[model samples]
Target chain A: MRADMIPLAFRDPVHDSQSAFRRLLRALSRPGTPVSLPGPAEAPEPMGGPLAAIALTLADADCPIWLDPALSTERVRRYLHFHTNAPQLADPRAAAIALIGDAGWLPGLNGFHPGDAPYPDRSTTLILQLPALTGGSTVRLSGPGIETTTSLAPLGLPNWFWPAWHENAARYPLGVDIFLTDDRAVVGLPRSTNVEVP
Target chain B: MGIDLAFDDHGVYSFAYLDEMTKRMIRRAILKAVAVPGYQVPFGSREMPLPPGWGTGGLQVTASLLGREDMLKVIDQGADDTTNAISIRRFFARVAGVATTERTGEATVIQTRHRIPERALTEDQIIVFQQPQPEPLRRFIPHEVVARKLHAFAQYGVMYVRLYEDISRLGHVAMSSDYPVIVNGRYLASPSPIPKFDNPKLHRSRALALFGAGRERRIHAIPPFTDVKSLDFVDHPFTVQHFESCCSLCGAQDSYLDEILLDDGGRRAFVCSDTAYCAEQRGERTKS
Candidate 1:
């Protein structure tokens, strides 16, 4: 931690961003379970509380972060660009990292590359901030990382997300990975993780 | 309600960038590479802030695929201590917060420019090459159109013509830097800009081969047994260069020699091309 160059407008919340990030990985490798982050940050601009956490957790110069029209602002752009060198792209497909906290404008999750059968992991990871995401949904999650069963709040993806993702998983090797971030948490849904979605 | 005096100040070092999504992209590429084994996939490349020819491409692959518990090795011109090598090694240590190592055997992901390590790699290891141009036909003719056709149909006649031209005109292939090779019979690719001395090392390796060109926006892979063929005329055949000198730093014979200039008298100093390789070999001899 470089104590000298702390940005004045940055989030000083005492949450372990790194630990949350580590948890993000486990969630990604394991799928569907919620992992909490410090979050609830004052996201640069246009973005809300939950979105702030996603940007703080994933933004970097190396990754391409596509900010939707629903959450665009000069302050947000400058902050992300200055901090993480993460270039903002016009198209979501070109993005290495896609940040969509607004449930309404988020693209159909299946529109991005799901991956190829031989190389099924080529899909884009959609980081979606769910609408009131708290557990108690009947969705049964099972797959590569999950042993028996798990459940969580309805991941606020597009209505078309499940059908598209099911087709995606059927292809195997080629598929997208997903991260569902709620108030202060995030979880993964890799293609390998089978979803009953009942 | 309590009055608050604190203002928001974002501190340094946020969570890592290569998120599960991005990591999934690279991992999927790797899994496909494992499945078909050696076919290269043309992926949509992201624009990293760094310029091309820099280690940005390799860094992307390294960042995306690295797990929390992985040791990374970065090498340039075969030496792990080269300034560029050090820069990349430090990059991962800072960003991904992963471990770095000079020892080849300990590293799970070895990001390299030019030559592969003198020590053999294992199945667990992956070598990512920083490629300036991923297309094999760049040298023969700079036409992407024709090159694409050549690669699409496995028509590598032009490469042979160039090699035969070298053998006939100079008695040896006079090309060095970004040598072309046929990977998996169908795809002809460049092995980054490594000198031709490292060409033979690509044969029958246990480790995976991934090539990325950030400027060109492409990523591809070569799996084991993929049959990487360096374009050669049957008559002239393929050849690798060897320096007939010992390393002054760690005196070992039969190693790739990097030319260094000594005093004003114009004397030359020859040392191991692989810096860590030289140190390891010498350390072994001293211990024995």
Candidate 2:
């Protein structure tokens, strides 16, 4: 926990969060892109590395957040409470944002609301903290949001996720947005974009 | 209990829960909503402490719009004290500390469930709906693949067929809750779960309406006085329902009512669906 909170420095927190946050906006605005955020901050354990940094970037009093119960602890909750006033959600489907350290046990993306064509932008954003964030071996990506057939070498993703994401993207404007974070950085692949696994 | 000031470090979490970047993204979405007028925009939703099917999305929009001078009102199915509504009201009182009201006339913003307030809402007021499912096509096809294409191209045959199917089966469209509507003749939007009975209130409404689905990560809007139509065929047509009984609790004839049972005798009673509106009307009568 101590390692995860070292970056909440008031003197430099705003400055550091600025660059990372700008990129998150860019990533969401245009999906299926890997934009690495600079992070040396200590993220709460389980959240690990860049994902934790992203948590700091997005958590706020405005958005309600939910996390896998296994990753939640008194200290971590306390830190998050102090950092982001975001209420803890009991149901993952109701949260505006969620953090999933392990994707194996997560529910399907379809349970989420995909906004209609007249209002097609309703969906959830999931941050899956994986063991590694590589774009080479585990999966290959190609779609509207990616530059040129990008690859996501994710570590330890459940077998069901790839096909599920394919189904999610099939919804076009209405699907879950994703962010995969590991020991070093974070990469996003929104449902508007497509993915392929090798 | 000692409050910790150490976590206020700027480097960790920014002043607001969302980094300026996330807020900017939301701000951009808001601008688009304004531009399109009655369109729902897909956004990246964050997790809140509350559940999804509840008012988390409305709370998010309320949180985003709140400041030092805002008065917030939250109601469920139009009732002020329904457990979930009370919970959300208490949530804002704790987190944002904005002023709260049970009077629709006094509130700057109202977060609501199924029904709109019985009292006419003003132009300055913004009503936010806690949407369980923002996608109108979701139940029709149950296939994301089919729903998206239909929506993108405005191929809403499934919805028409479903409504027609209801008319064929129930004689009057067996729909009672969360009726879907097309806003401004272009954007197909959900009116949340507010029964078709409330459909007339959507057309030319004075208030600015916003819809948010927390779990779905989507947000949409309706500018003041916009044209909103529930999808229906010309020959079949569409209509709203009004309870024949006045409230057994409040005794108001024009207001929406809720049906409550008394005991094992199957005895039931009707009450105002909008508790605050009921109380306010009673107050007006007493004063008169």
- In candidate 1 the C-alpha lDDT for residue A30 amounts to 47
Scored on chain A only, each candidate's TM-score is 0.79, 0.83
Error of 1 at B58 (Å): 0.4
Q: Give, for candidate 2 chain A, the lowest lDDT window spanning 10 residues.
A: A2-11
Tens digits of per-residue lDDT for model 2 on B1-288?
A: 997777424334333344454654564464345334445576767777787888777767665655445678888988777898888877766655567877788888899988888888886677888888888877767886676566678777778788888888877777777777887556577888998878778776767677778887777776555677888878778877778899876689988788899999999999888887787766653111
Grade the docking of candidate 1: incorrect
**TM-scores of all predicted structures:** 0.57, 0.57
Q: Name the candidate that leads on lDDT.
A: 2
What DockQ does every candidate get?
A: 0.04, 0.04
Candidate 1 structure quality by residue, lDDT tens digits, A112-188: 65644333334466777676556435567765444457775564555766777677666554566667766666677
Write down the TM-score for model 2: 0.57
Q: Given candidate 2, what's the lDDT at residue B36?
A: 46
Stretches off by above 4 angstroms in model 1 are A1-198, B1-15, B33-40, B140-145, B284-288
* Count of clashes, each model: 15, 41
Q: Which ten-residue region of model 2 chain B has the weakest summed lDDT?
A: B7-16
- The per-model lDDT (C-alpha) reads 0.65, 0.68
